[model samples]
Target: MRTSIVFLSALATSVMGANSTTYTLPAGFNVGLVDSSERSAWCSAQRNTCPDICQDGTRLNSCDSNTLDFSCVCADGSTPDVTPFKQTVPFFVCQANYGQCINSHPDDAEGQRTCKKNAVCGSKNATEEADSSSSSTTTAASTTLAMATSTDSTASQTSSVAAASATTSNPAVALGGDMTKYSTGFMAGLMFVAARMIL
Candidate 1:
C-alpha cells in the first residue's frame, strides 16, 4: 500500500507538467504522451527520415533524459540505450488507442498528430466518472474516490493533461479501469497526493 502511494505521487508529479496528456496507470506504472520531440528529432537527424511505425510493448531509442538527447525507453521505465542507438528502431508518437501505433505524421509536434492510446484513464473520453451510482458498497469511500479523481482531472484537464487517482479503500488499484493511458512521471506524483489524502 505504501508503495502504491509512492507510485501515486509519481503519477501526480508527471501530471503537473503542462500540456502533457496524463492518465491513471496501474500501481508502479505511469504512462504519458509527452513531447519526445528532441529525441524524435534527434533520431530523424540521424536517420534523416522520421520513423513511420511503433509497436506497443516495444521500446524505441529516442530521448535521453540526463542529456536531453535520444535514448531507448519503454512504458515500464526501461532505457536500454542510454545514448542514441547506432541504428534506428521503430518509433512512433502515442496514438489514440493508447498503444504505440503507426505514426500518421511522426514529424508533427506533440499533440498535433492524433491517435488513440489504448484505454488511458485520462484520455479525452476514456475517463471514468466515480459517483453515488457506484455499487462498491462503500458509499463514503466511493465519494472520496470520486473526489480524488475529480480533483486531479479538474486541475489537469484544462491543458488536457491526463491525471490518475484512486479511492481510499484501494490505493494500490488505479481508480479508472477502462483505458490505457500515458504521460510523464507527473501523473504518479498527483496520485501520490491523492493517496496521501486517503492516508
Candidate 2:
C-alpha cells in the first residue's frame, strides 16, 4: 500500500510538470480548420484562468468566463438601446425639440432704430465742431457755473492755451513792424537831414 501511494504521488507531479510547458499561440489566437464556433467551453474548477474565449458573429456576442461570473459590463458611453434606429434610415436621436429665434442685426432690430426719430445716423467730420456742439449743449442746459470746491484745472488749461495763441499771433514784438518801427526810423533820418542842412 505504501508503494502504490508513492507511485500515484509521482504520477501527479509528472502531470503538473508536463502542463507547465510554454504555449506558442498563432496570430489572432486562431487555430484554423477546427470549428471553434461549435466547440463547447470545457469549463472546470481549473478553468478559472482559461486564456481565451470563442466569439460568435451574431447579435449576441461571445461569453466571458471569470472565477464567479456576476453581471455583464456595458461599454463606455453606451447603453443597450431598444430602438437602435428610428426607422432603419437612421435619423438623429436625442435632438433639441425647441425653436430658437435670434435677431442677427441686434442693433437695428427688435423695436430699436439705428438713430433717433429725426436725427441722421452719420459721422462728424471735424473734432472742433463736435467739441463746440457738446460744450454749447452743456452750457445751454445750466443757469450758472457750478462753484468748484476743488482747484480750477480747466481755467489754468485755458490760460495756457490763450498765452500760446497770443505768442503765435504777435511774433513781431521786439523786432518791430512796418507800422511803428519803420515810421520811427523815417522820422529820425529826416531829423539828421535837417541837422546837416543847419550845419
Candidate 3:
C-alpha cells in the first residue's frame, strides 16, 4: 500500500509538471480581469470568433462564448504607446479569449491582422533584450556542461548546443507556438497510462 501511494504521488507530480507551462503576455499589453458581460460583448464584436482569434498560444481560459468566468482583456480597452508609435492607437484589441493584442487592420488583404505568438507589441528595452540573450546563453552553457564529459559526450553536446541555438533564434520554436496541442494530447495520454497503472 505504501509503495502504491508513493508511485501514485510521483505520477501525479509528473502529470501536473507536464501541464505546468504558463502563458506570458507579450510586451506592450496589460491584462485586466473583465466580467463575463464585457467579454461577451467583445466576443460578439469579433463575430464570435474568439477561439480563432485567440489561438496564438496565449489564451488562459477556454474559448467558449458562453463562459461566465472573468477573462483577460486589454487594460482600459487599448494598448497605448506601442513601440515605434508615440501615440495611443485604437486599432489593436485584446483577444477576448486571451489577453494578447490583435492588430485589426481593415485595409489588409485578409481584413484581419494577426500578430505572431509571443510577439512584442511595444518597444522592448535594451535591458530586457540583454536579459533574454544572456538567459539563452546560460541555458546553452549549462546544457553543454551536463551533456559533455569526454570526447563522445563532446560530439553530442555540440549537436545539442547547435539545436538549442537554432531554437533560440527561431521565434516560433522559442515561443512554443506549435507545441500546445501536442503537449495537451501527450499529457492526456500520460494521465490515462498513469490511471491504468494505478488501478
Candidate 3, residues 1-199, lDDT tens digits: the string is 9999999999977854443322333345543554666655644433323222232222322223343222222223321122221111111232432243344443553433344443333333433444577789999998887766566777878887776655444544544756455666775665565455434
lDDT of 1 by residue, 1-199 (tens): 9999999998865643422222222332212344456444544642322121111232333433222334333444443321122223222222222443324335655433333333223121101112222345577787999999999888766433232233432433554642236454656765677666645
> For model 3, what is the error of residue 112's alpha carbon versus the real structure, in angstroms, after optimal superposition?
17
- How do these models rank on lDDT, best leading? 3, 1, 2
Best-fitting candidate, measured by TM-score? Answer: 3
TM-score of each: 0.16, 0.15, 0.18
Error of 1 at 184 (Å): 91
Candidate 2 local Cα displacement, residue 113, angstroms: 68
Ordering by TM-score:
3, 1, 2
Q: List ranges where model 1 is wrong by over 4 Å.
A: 1-41, 45-56, 59-68, 82-84, 87-199
Q: Report lDDT (Cα) of residue 193, candidate 1.
A: 71
What is the clash tally of candidate 1?
A: 55
Q: Give the range of the ten consecutive residues with the poorest summed lDDT in model 2.
A: 89-98
C-alpha lDDT score of every prediction, in listed order: 0.38, 0.32, 0.42
Report the C-alpha displacement of residue 81, candidate 2, in angstroms. Answer: 37
